[model samples]
Target: MLRQAQHERVHEGFAVEAVDLVKEFGETRAVDGVSLAVPSGSIFGLLGPNGAGKTTTLRILLGIIDPSSGTRRVLGHERPLEAAREVGYLPEERGLYPSMHARDAIAFVGALRGLPLREGRRRADELLEEHGLGEWARRPIRNLSKGMAQTVQLLGTIIHGPRLIVLDEPFSGLDAINQARLEELIRRQAREGATIIFSTHVIAHAERLCERIAIIAQGRVAFEGSVDEARGRLRPIVRLRTRSQDGSWRSAIPAAARLHNGEWVFELPEGGPEPLLKALIDGEAGIETLAIERPGLHDAFVAIAGDAAAEAMGHQEPSE
Candidate 1:
């Protein structure tokens, strides 16, 4: 399958690169010294809370807006607009003529990206049918439901078969079912060899979709690496329930261990659990239950971005 090939394919160079990008609006510095390198044919995520400058950074990378003092390259072009034909962008603010037919709207967007009008129309129909919107092809944008209209805009975004696609909050305002569908669509696009970069405050989506991510907080990058690497910032947790309330087994527990609801929880010991388990057994500490739990993305995010940023993210999506 194409996805298999994509996994096997060795990426040579970055599809997009930005160096110390800084965007300022008068006294407000929106993006401060942000840098990123998106691998070719990879799904990269820009994760942060609202007003964290993710949108400003994306705009700077795409040349939609100029940075105060920074440089960026898109698809190997020093000037992002020079490679406009190979890139597709979906802004945070969704807009389409309300009176335009769905097919026509998509075709028009394709035409802006250099796709021939006739071919664009043909591809629009094919995309609509493939996505279960064939019957609504001729429907006016104003008449379509919010989800349907958003779907139409998404279809239009990819109609040109762009090499690099940038989406700002792509899952915002989407229903659960439509959000799942959008996630699949993003995966399919990556499978087809497109480099996808999307910004979202919802950590769950980023955790599931992106191999590498940049966590932005207060206009600065807090962390940039693989998901596993981010999670590795905190040690795995150990939860234990002991039959004996007081014994030598308590000595084996770390000083930081805390008892909550009859369970002793603490960070995993550095030397490994074998010694601890043996100590528990040898000390006559009847172990009712013992489990090692790895820290998840949310824990990592809280560790990296601090409680305030995590609270901002919490308002948008539930953490795992």
Candidate 2:
């Protein structure tokens, strides 16, 4: 499969491709007709609420489970496991031998993927030092903090120098500092020519790290494309707060405007903000604050996936 990929002449430049993939457990369909194409050397995100089948889709892509129907390719290999040596995966469920030393655990995982024990140990040492865990390298997993253990496990995932890295909910249990560090690491890896695919229910991470994203909801893909394109689905918003409730100035407000926390928030209508501002000023509306709000990924997600899915994911209402 590797050879075929090398000589196939047709280059879609895709690091991973899942076409109409489906997974079923009894009568329940976990992932239904999910299709994705992740570009090479890019950071991609699979975003959705809990039980949205993101894990199922990833498992199928990793060859951990077979799809009920459809096909997929990893690193251009039609058979995903055929490219196993070139891929690194960190599952949502994390585990490390409590008694094992941090460095040794990394080495062991590397060794399983055909990296020599000595070389693995050497790389583990460098990775630990680079990630600010130099003093904890030889510490037992049981003694390490949760953040440290997760870092070690991540180092293990990449110790073999895989070109493709897949992380499932990598930021779930991390503190803000650790999450920022992980985001930096992910960007660095992509800059070094590694394709990264991470799944998360938290939209913030995807907004910060991903160049391309897929929003999965209710066992299906709700949206897929560049972050800018997703946000483009909605128009710019205008939020205004006034010092007084003047009924005469109400005409300046668009019909779509909603009252929230003493503010009038609404999408800018056909004409821009200038006309509205002019009308408000002419009407002597005591404007306390007026600002144009760019629609964010969260707004796009709500628009694409619907309110129910957003609510299930605990996404705060836009006014918040």
Candidate 3:
């Protein structure tokens, strides 16, 4: 239990806080000293490759499983389940009774979260209709396609109007269309003042949806901060296409610059590009194309967590 003053300090503007959290299996440590602060009404992402302890950390935060060590507070409660009615959780492994109708399934989940059955059913119907699944409301869960069934489960997750929502790999198995829909839904929920924390191996989803993120790798936090800050780990890259193959203008290019498919690619210089641009012009380099590109989230992840982690994120390396 946290002291009143300490708890108040930690929860001032945060919906969830975990400190030095560690979860250990018999012979393995699944989560190693994970710490996170999720601000109220923010979309926070736990990003990592598979088996990186993201799920374990989330489960610990929600009090679904006791951590081997460390403390966590969710919605002002040290015991997260005490705030169950105000929190919604969508686990990685989705399940619904096959015999249950879609609406009933959603309402049942809401009821478990303390919503009245009648109101839950009403909200379930409204949600299904709004999400273009009204016709399937009465259909059995098993009767719906996988994507539709997943949608129903997602609707059920928020039927109780939770103040804090945790979704583990919410975009897994979703098609491009459904993935976009889920992203919009998440944004809407955050706009309405719900604090959301979702875990995903797909860095692209995190890059697109989250304002802040934590990158977990090998059961440890590799990095944690705002998305822009993550990208700032690497300098912007300068890619140039010039008419001349080799000339005095080449001296102006960074020594580390490499030729790749007819383009000179290198990190932007600390002094900026103006000097280099002037040098190139004076030397008649005939610059055809010049692009200074900021590092993307994928690049940042690779830099922070290594190539293996990037590969686990489902992105292929550029072929030579």
Per-residue CA lDDT of model 1 for 1-320, tens digit only, reads: 12223234426699999999988899999899998999998899999999999999998898989999989999888989998987889999999999999999999999999988998889999999998999999989999998899989998898888888899999998888889989999998988888999999999899999989999998999999899999999999999998999888788899999999999999988878998999899989899999999998989999999999999999978423
After superposition, the stretches of candidate 2 with alpha carbons farther than 4 Å from their true spots are: 1-12, 242-250, 260-262, 281-287, 315-320
- lDDT order of candidates, best first? 1, 3, 2
| Cα misplacement distance, residue 19 of candidate 3 (Å) | 0.7
TM-score of each model, in listed order: 0.94, 0.89, 0.93
TM-score for candidate 1, residues paired by index: 0.94
In the predicted model 2, the residue pairs found to clash are none
After best superposition, candidate 1 residue 76: deviation in angstroms? 0.4
Candidate 3 regions off by >4 Å? 1-12, 315-320
* Shift in Å, residue 150, candidate 1: 1.0
* Candidate with maximal TM-score: 1
TM-score of candidate 3 on Cα atoms, chains taken together: 0.93
Local accuracy by lDDT, each model: 0.90, 0.88, 0.88
Candidate 2 global CA lDDT score: 0.88
The ten-residue window of minimal lDDT in model 3 covers 1-10
lDDT of 2 by residue, 185-265 (tens): 898777767889999988888999999999999889989999999999998999899887876678878787999999989
* Candidate 1 Cα outliers beyond 4 Å, as residue runs: 1-11, 318-320
Q: Lowest summed-lDDT stretch of 10 residues in model 1?
A: 1-10
